[model samples]
Target chain A: MYFGGSFSRGDFLFLLSGAVTTLSITLVAVVIGTVLGVLFGLIRAGAPWWIGNTLGAVLDVFRSVPLLIQLVLFNSFNSMLKLNWPTFTVGCICLGIYASAFCTEIVRSGVGAVPQTTRRAARSLGLTWRQELTSITLPIATRIVFPSWIGLTLGVMKDTALVLWIGIVELLRSSQIVTSRVQEPLLILGITGLIYFVMSFPIARLGNQLEKKWGTQ
Target chain B: MDYEFQWRPVLRSLPEMLWGALQTIEIAGLAMMLGTVLAIFLALAKRSGKKYLSLPADMWIETARNTPALFQIYMLYFGLGSLGLQVGSYTALLLGITFNNAGYLAETFRGGFAAVPETQTRAARSLGLGAVQTQWHIVIPQMLRAVFHAMTNQMVWSVLMSSLGVIVGLTTDLTGVTQKLNVVTYRTFEYFFVAACLYYLISKAFTLSARVVAWRLFRY
Candidate 1:
């Protein structure tokens, strides 16, 4: 009896479109998050003490605050500042910013996990700081932190659902709209959950595979 | 740009904000207590050798971990209502938060179980203790230590996530009141700043309490 009165093919399509939007947002956010995370990690790991401390404080504040609050704050701020950025853009920025905090710590830990000997060897080869980081440090660190990084990436994808609360029309929001019409909450939720699982399952499996392959090395 | 900072609106809303903070703590405490009990069962079930016992537990953990807590709350609150269950928003919110908390807490306890040395468990068994007795007396104490920090981390997360219950129309929680104030006063910074401070204080208090408990429990 689920989806009984008001179900239609269009509702399924809307849900599918919502999944697409979620995926797109996650993809963009993850890309931005990883790049910024690496930059912040490098700064924290190798920069001057003042620079490192500033980035460290930023990470702490960002990580401590809830993502929901950050999203809402950013959305309101965007309007207040007259930035005229789309809600989706604000959603992506907030997500990327939030994810980057965790990612920075992950990347910093990876960088720290690299041995002092390696750094010394790179310096002995007359490589500059940037050169040594690119050639020696990051490669090893990436391998070392692949598991946790992948875990954080999956976390980002899941956290994107929060954007729906701000009216982003992501999967859950789409499902809510459909459920309101169809009056079959369980079935709608089950379907929406299945959609999320389908999206998340492959990433998680890939993460596991990466962890198994690189974690031991 | 001419911007005036308004303190009066925020001041007027302070009492409601305080009430919201109380509600936030109430939801968090209830959810954490329920979650801890559920987590113990989940940890045990996952560690159980039988597939029948372990598979469902594993599925629950994976699903909860992979999806957003927001979606889970929506599914419970709005999705359930659309199914004709007719539960109140607060009941739905609590159920959703407890379910998600149990999922994460299960992982924490599982980590603790993994950290418990097998030799200790074996020593207890050789002393003629049954599985339950060995678990209760020998394994659990050690496991609790390993899990303590992780549980504290989960508590902080649960407090933050409880904010999402506002979307489901639970008007008593901190996030709920913030949303209401934001709509009415259009004072984003003032309202969110207050809410943020409240959350920060609560999380700090939780962290300090956990530290005290860990010191007393571990004694080293």
Candidate 2:
């Protein structure tokens, strides 16, 4: 009967909802991460001497450890500190923090790639440091970093699966539930893999196109 | 409320954790070696210009890249088991990682291959070197050197990814052993912290050695 029975309509809907949850979590984390990443990027690249160096060193710890460990540690931190937030909030926080570290590096390098002559030109034209960064450095840097940003987006989407470790029941967890109930692990997992492929392929191909286009300029 | 930090349990379990770290390295090293070999064939298949070879290679790379490594491992371990094909946890983890690594590395190698200009291939042919001989003697070496740093990054990835083995009831690796220890003693912070440190140390060691190796091999 395990092999004989096919998935019901409800099963398909449950899996689709899981996909929605996965996308939602990824979307929120990307927004939070991008904002925090830009702030940290500016701090590392533009702030005063000790501040920048210290922030860089601190973020390196996040970069070095695995995200799974980061999730567990964050859970412990939440419990120990008695914050008692929901698991989804904790998942979003951990992923946001994780993405911030990498994005900080991405942003810093993107900004760094801007030529010094361009910055000086802005300065000579009476632009303040803030104006220079916003009008001149950031626009050029953003184009340079767009391709890497696409790669990062794809990465964070896939990594949302790890949140299932803390029992958030996203796409992968949904499939696991179905497989356990149906005794059809291969079919469930195959469908899950296909879903992820559908989601990520276009982004990756777009990144390639962007790289070629931006690379020429 | 003050949450007092304790260190003794973590200290006492240091040896077990160290052994776990060794197993982590063992799995990652083996996967990298296996994956790199498979990746060369994959890269060649993509470059072969035949529809069958290139299409399959592209599919594998896209599937491996697009999906989470966890999905790949689950399909191999649980999915296969349900389909009546049982593999041990270690083999499943290794194969999953190798599949992922080979896919990513195949792309990295393709970039490296492209970096070697077409004129070089033409020159090799003009010099009467056979195709295999040309690739073996010239293209592969340059490709290795060009992509050496990317390979090092992938090696670090494999090590970190080995931590996912804990999900599949793998008990021998660092994260698995840490989880088991966490169960016995609820010193979650201390044990996980130590495991993180071990991972960081392993990655640092690999990265440092990679630089030295790069300097030596690529000096020409």
Candidate 3:
């Protein structure tokens, strides 16, 4: 019944804090996911048959399953393993693992898009496998996959919300807490949606711009 | 640290789990159907020369596209509940799926519509067809051809997003059943493995069917 009370000072701080937490988790997860994605992408792209297939299977299992279930499993597994990890750390790890699957696909596609001639030419120039990958293949592949990478990043940002189910005090969780305290659901939810909109809009806009630019190139 | 892995409890839950899988498919199918219609309308409206109509349609599409489906469901289910306008979890789930699907489908259809040649629309108009007639006879058919693959991608997304319904208390879906079984048996690996298999099978079926439709419709 406290309609106007939800807009009070403390509730705003609480929601803002939640937004910050969500952003921090997403940022850390994206960085780790991108690194893992690149490694997995290399395995999928240029590794030997057994290695590539093994990595491919790992990516497939992660991608095919729902994030909620993955989050739950990892949270429990962390406890069973007695890792003493914080829930936020576990949330970040789960999100990173999930994001890496999609990123690996994007990165692998990017790497594959690099013409075979480039690799052959690099080899003819006496480049080592590591040198060829770092100097030639990865650069060209990154250009090709830039748009998809951006799109996946946006997806990862939005997915940070899923951690709320595991008791992470993300934006959605904050809104729930505020609703309980002040009992103004519409305003709180509306504000939460707006906050999410703010966080997501720039990334999506950047994704579109990159796609358009890269499409022309 | 040696805990016995039991298959008996998971096996006992198979029938109910299968039932939940069916419900997940049913919900995804219905949502996709409804959302496609909404997408067509939004796509066409956005393409209409009228600025007012296109502007709001653009805003709706952008908003829905930018946010996560989980947030939308949470907003509809819990957010609306806070306003004293409680909706059934299933209804809220459907609304969320439909909303997300519509946004994605609008983009897909819009891309398809863009792929259609302007000359085709002009030719239809020159033949004395009205705007509506031009859209139906000249634009839609060609657009559908271009959108076939994109539509299949959206269907995959819808199937995946349907898993979020479990969070809002809609427990009659595959993810929900998996979660419940996981809780009871602590058989994480088995439950998630089975759920992933179900998702892959369903998505593969959709992909195959879509390919067939694409072949038939756009065969030269």
Q: Stretches of candidate 1 above 4 Å error?
A: A1-6, B82-84
Native contacts retained, all candidates in order: 0.56, 0.69, 0.49
Each model's lDDT = 0.86, 0.91, 0.85
- Which pairs clash (backbone N, Cα, C closer than 3 Å) in model 3? none
Top TM-score hit: 2
What is candidate 1's lDDT per residue for A1-217, written digit by digit as tens? 5545877899899999999999899889988899899989988988899999899987777776778888878987887788989999999999998888888989999999999998999999899988998889999998888888878887888888899867898888888788778877788788988988887778788887988777665
Best by DockQ: 2
CAPRI category for model 3: medium
Q: Grade the docking of candidate 1.
A: medium
* Candidate 2 residue lDDT tens string, A79-197: 88999999899999899988898899899999889998999999999999989989999999999998988898899999999999988999999998887677778888888888888
TM-score of each: 0.94, 0.97, 0.91
- Report the TM-score measured on chain A for model 1: 0.93
Q: Residue-wise lDDT of candidate 2 within B72-154, one digit each (tens)?
A: 99989997897789998999999999999999999999999999888889999999999999999989998998899999999
Per-residue lDDT over A128-214 for candidate 3, one digit per residue giving the tens place of the 0 to 100 score: 998998899988888888878888888888888889878899988888888887777778888888998998888778878888888
For candidate 3, write residues B78-178 as lDDT tens digits.
77786788998888988998998998899889999999999999999999999989988789988988888778878877778888988888878998888
Stretches of model 2 off by over 4 angstroms after superposition: A1-5, A48-50
Evaluated against the true structure, the overall lDDT of model 3 is 0.85
Range of the 10 consecutive residues with the lowest summed lDDT in candidate 2 chain A: A1-10
Please state the Cα-based DockQ of model 3 relative to the true two-chain complex.
0.52
User: Residue B145 CA error for candidate 1 (Å)?
Assistant: 1.6
Candidate 1 chain A lDDT trough over 10 residues, lowest sum:
A1-10
